[model samples]
Target: MLLLVAAVGILAVVGFVTFLKLSPQSTPISSQPSTSTKEVNALSLYHWWTSPGESAAINSLFGVFKNSYPDVAIIPAPVSGGAGFQIFPLIQSLVNAGEAPDAFQMHAGYEARPYYDAGLLEPIDALWQSEKLESVIPKVIRDMTQFDNHYYSIPVNVHRVNVVWYNQKLLKQNGIDASRLTTWDSFFAACDKLKAAGVKYPIQMGPTWTASHIFEQILASQGVSFYENFINGKILSAQDPTLNQALTTFKKFLSHVNPDNSTTVKDWDDAIRRIIKAEGAFSIMGDWANGEFKLIGMKHNTDYGTIPVPGTNDMYGLCIDTFQHPKAASHPTNSDRWLKVVASKAGQDAFNPIKGSIPARTDADVSLYDDYQKGAISDFNKSTYMYPSIVHGSGMPSSFKLKLNDIVDNFVQTQDINKAAVAIVNQIQSTLPEFTKVWSLE
Candidate 1:
């Protein structure tokens, strides 16, 4: 009886040990899947920077990524078109065809909002958290890229939208000192001098979007709080007397622009040509225009001087650009590796200088930039004068942009101030619903 009981006990112990070995939790470590070993092989990147200078700038970034990941091959697919032409249609087609690149550069505004809403954009929240981008990029830029508590895109640099690039020789010839013109009245006074001196086009303006940008500058100078209130739908219409005054101020400036000014000159390159040849005494445009000036061998603060848009106290505004990542072909590992490299510190440092804007990273040293860029960086540090570009913010989607373009085009052509004001009011009323919907989502 004792031997039979001992034999049963030994069998039970052996059975229990066999069951433990077969359990899922007890699988050998080598047999389990490992996430760390995953690798990316190749990446396809798409962007709209075809200009020689822009290509050079972007190549520097690509070079750095290659250095870091020599094993991962990068295929750059560049799309031609300066900033504002529609590239979305092409991207939409590619996505529908199941050929979306691993990553593409997009605007930071409502232009990107649709992609985020559609779930086409991969939320970089996980990557941002891992990299602590919040601590690296400036709060303003970080805030601009984020929507609904998540970052949708990365801003490579910040460009001042409300800049008035002027011909130093032209201004001096007219005895008009740009320094004394801090307010709208003084700015208009200078324009009057230019006009009186037979400067046919005292201001070079064009591109439907640029007209809207000018309107935004006027609105911001009035007071960004006022602009925000209207944009948020707190003030329903432009019927407010303040709105009328802003419209009037814009119309007055419109009168001094080129007579042939129409949306037809809807290209920055065309505007640059007019400026370089001194056909237009001044141009109210973004700092990116500096690239054109540089190409023409114009010296900053000498051949041309940059000033805040007339009547605005701030020298800074929206900074916009795109980042491209390698396309994920057969190798998911290569695609992932390229994404990681673009988001790294070395990548930003290599790209921003050639791109002509301060690095999106706040910790970057601005001393490496040119004098104009250094000044821009210093002004941005102040933070008090900064506001996002309207086109980059709520001002874009409300269809108010289209209406403002119409108003400016009309005001410039016919000089009908009252009609322009009324048109603006109607646009405000029509755009309020869309504007409210977007802001509420925020």
Candidate 2:
């Protein structure tokens, strides 16, 4: 039965990919009204939400959309990657070919600006006012969804990136209280204790992007003020002592990491699997790890425990998932319909619980969310500082992001702190234009 179900799912995703090749010549009436009996209207939805929990969450939102517009079918085009690295480039290619999906998933901040600047995106400010989203969504989120005072996309959820997940049994066996890991000094000490207790890979991480994610968290741990300065360009990588400290600290972290699976594991969930099997003591990852945990029937605070990554208690690393309408959408009305559903409170309520993220809406019901989500919500509402995630395409431009990922990946493999620091400085020195452009847009 599982195999049969898996086959059906694969067939559905395959169908969506096939539809992307249907050119104007193939569908002569593609421009006609969706409700017209002569035309079959379909909305193509592209995203990386292919995991079990994410699939279920998206289905919940699609269910609401389908009920309201029974005549329209949603084509799901999901791609796999740690951080949409594999899928986003494909999305760019589709845009270049004028075959963009009706509504596609993207990060909320500077990530979407390149497409917007190229005149590939269509603004949804009219729907924003019509749906009265201003009352429900937070002002910061509203600001994030806009470029040049025009709302271009609707944010669906906010993912906190600096979460540390741990195997509760391993920690207990090692006589290390999880609460003591609130700072780097304590965390390293705990790693030592876990090593002494025979726990391998006390800190588990995946490939390229995961290393970047950890690097960002280490920078955040320096303090909110320093993080803001660093990301905002007030501080330079080579000139700032704190930046050097962060790189050095991250390099030290690699020593405790299990080298055996560093190359073998490529997905974030794979690292979570190691922690689940008790082979690793802890993993610093985004809250989405909770979704994977639930997929395998692991209960939070029981089989696992979570905390803010060391020295980041009052800070939230933002990774918002949003949907944007392309100017070249074949079915503009259908795209609007999809966006309306995604931006609605009902949509957030249906999707966020399963996706392991807090609703972007400030007015969402807290009771519907799990304990971790509720905690995220509470922190988001009153956090001392909120910073965009560098690894998730918000803090830096796409060009700088790719370079930083390459640097972090190399650093992870070589564990050469000085070389990594110089590489980062050189990249930042050369790619300041890209970074500056993104910052100015904000």
Q: What is each predicted model's overall lDDT from 0 to 1?
A: 0.65, 0.79
Mind giving the per-residue lDDT tens digits that candidate 1 earns over 287-324? 77776776657788888888888766653677476443
Q: Ten residues in a row with the worst lDDT in model 1?
A: 1-10
Estimate the lDDT of model 2: 0.79
In the predicted model 2, the residue pairs found to clash are none
In candidate 2, stretches whose alpha carbon ends up further than 4 angstroms from where it belongs are 1-39, 237-239, 260-262, 436-442
RMSD of each: 15.7, 4.5
Counting clashing residue pairs in each candidate, in order, gives: 10, 0
